[model samples]
Target: MNFATRPNFEAISSAPVMQRARGTARIGTKQRDGKTCIDTLFQEGCGKIRLPRTHSSALEAVFINTAGGITGGDHLRWGADIAPEGRLVITTQACERSYRSTGDTAHVEADINVGADAHLDWLPQETILFEASKLDRRLTIRLDEGATLTAIEAVLLGRDAMGEEARDAQFSDTWRIFRGDRLIHAEATRLTGDGSERDGLSLLRGCRAFASILHVAPSADRAEQLLDRVRALHPAAGLIAASANGERLVIRAMARTGLALRKLLVPTLIELTGAGSLPRLWHL
Candidate 1:
């Protein structure tokens, strides 16, 4: 098979056990045999990364850095610099689980810089917090005038099938959005034992799974209206949504079970953004 010529970032590490054995390409993309590799280092481990360049269409990429099923601490940092006139999409292979942070809180930092007229989608799978685990995340995104971006963040409590509850867990996340050189949105959420019982009602509402999807576009009003329709479709306690500055749409959802919340959000996102279903890794 002939492969297109494109530039790829250099690989600096790998995990012998977690690495991808071979390479495969999906529809409408190029293939790089063994380009995806997973490696763990002394303080951190690197997961698979796919950076494919499409000539007639938008470029696409994926980065994996951690996992709970592998019995190792998980930490990941990824960023995409979409040159002007470039477009790209990103996703992961599975949900990241921050097991008990015996050493320090599991950390992840994502930075995205979308050039003028460029588009970027920073969509990864969900992240689960296990008993006594702690996570601190910071997402910083910058877009040039006329650039567009969509980002999704999902979180789950203790592993349900394992019967592990979040009674003793701690998690915190902070998100910041900027356009050009101004701050447009900033949010922070923390879950700890002290206020779990009280704040849970206002946030989790007895649900073990929660997710937020933010889509920013010039027609934010239309997006918000679309979110309103979705909220109206879901049961009152299952989902919620809100509008922002007529160009950004933020939707939040909670469910007694993980599957329940996903079922509610997937259709809404597909309808609103015209994007495909989330990656298979999120279900785990």
Candidate 2:
């Protein structure tokens, strides 16, 4: 058969390559009428971000992933910049879902910048991982000397109410923060295993929900108070701990259900901060 007349073997060999989704979002603030205003926004591909109408003085941003969920080979990136003396809170429109993977791992990265005297709350919602999902995510933040950062992240191994369990999974998440080029926090959590493994149980004592809250430019008294509160409250049925390392305060919580974890985290943070205020979109 003539090469031209027949099927192009080389082209056919590559014709079925999976086309993964890619997205990027950028948000920035500016001074408007002597107040911090979100004046710059960008969205590309499947990622979109917008400022919601909020009664509070602080700027509120909500990120939307139009593709609905992430799977293997997908990539998403987000960046936010807060002007000097500005206050901003960032969150997702809903929980991010990671589906089962059949190929390469999904990737996500976030970059945040807070100017001098600025305050930022990086409070994105939880991420849910289904069985066999593969993912890697990283967050980097740069804060000016006087800036303050409050960030929270959570992960769920599957929906307990849905009767779904994630046993076969691979995930890694890392965070790095710097204040004026001086590193304040650098940490990573990695897990990988088959459908059944005793070692996985040791990772969390078989807990399905895990979360971490970190405050930079630290709060020792509040951290200690909250730690005592959590320990006093949940003497059993879950795990909660807190520690301070120099200028960073870290709190970690794990539970049998994702809701249980959130219940423990939200109230403690609010009680510590003296603000019942959370991301406007948060439910329970």
Candidate 3:
């Protein structure tokens, strides 16, 4: 065989680049002295949990990704079970970053089970996608009858402060939440690439940071007050909007800057669910 015309041996067997990380974490709830606690927990690989911290009456579970960030061919799985009457809050230690991928897309999946009368707050931090990155993430919640569930998902196109540009990226994020056999809320957000950011379709309207919050419970108390507060804080006419149908509340917000988008998130969450102050790691 001709040496130069033959297939390159080194390129065909690139062993190191194909290695990927996998993480799994599971948390189960229980009762102790009339208070809810994390009864059973399992963590491996990059998935980790910060021992529940005393937070008034509820327990806070802080999840950490030891791999630091995700890239092509990486997989992350997280799950939690809320016992009857258990109240728990979950948050990430810091924003998760998705890097440019040369091969397969990165994946993140979360499954939450809430028992009757149980309350769960799924508040993971933002996911930032770098230029040419590919990420597909999904979160599913199965709530028993009378269960209270709240969740927030945020995404940033690129690192705005660093003057970086996400000229090309692929993102598909989905949320499916159910109560018993009924599906109360279903949302899917997709960005095939970064071409639409500068367009004039009115969708996103050149915004780099976007967020969505879903609350399903017996009551959406102070929601009107939360709307008023959102309007007061964000005088910008259409940056934020909220709607409610009995116990289900949905809020969507976008901003040209991350600071502004967050300004709308914190206060809205505090006033809407009245879930007490933001998670401590959120401030740090």
Each candidate: RMSD: 13.2, 3.1, 3.6
TM-score to native of every candidate shown: 0.73, 0.88, 0.89
Stretches of model 3 off by over 4 angstroms after superposition: 1-16, 219-238
Q: Evaluated with TM-score, which candidate comes out highest? A: 3
Off by over 4 Å in 1: 1-47, 51-56, 66-75, 195-199, 220-225, 228-237, 274-284
Better of 2 and 3 by TM-score: 3
Across 15-96, the per-residue lDDT of candidate 2 in tens digits comes to 6788798999999997677567987899999999878877766788898899999999999999999898888888999999
lDDT of 1 at 137: 80
Candidate 1: global Cα-lDDT?
A: 0.63
Residues 192-279 of candidate 1 have per-residue lDDT tens digits of 7565552466666677788887877756666567657756666655465655656777777777666776787776665443234433
Q: How many collisions between residues are there in candidate 2?
A: 0
Give per-residue CA lDDT, model 3, range 98-153, as digits (tens): 99998799999999999898888888888898988999999999999778877899
Q: Measured by TM-score, how close is model 1 to the native structure? A: 0.73
The global C-alpha lDDT for each of the candidates, from Candidate 1 onward, is: 0.63, 0.82, 0.82
* Comparing 1 and 3 on lDDT, the stronger one: 3
lDDT value for model 2: 0.82
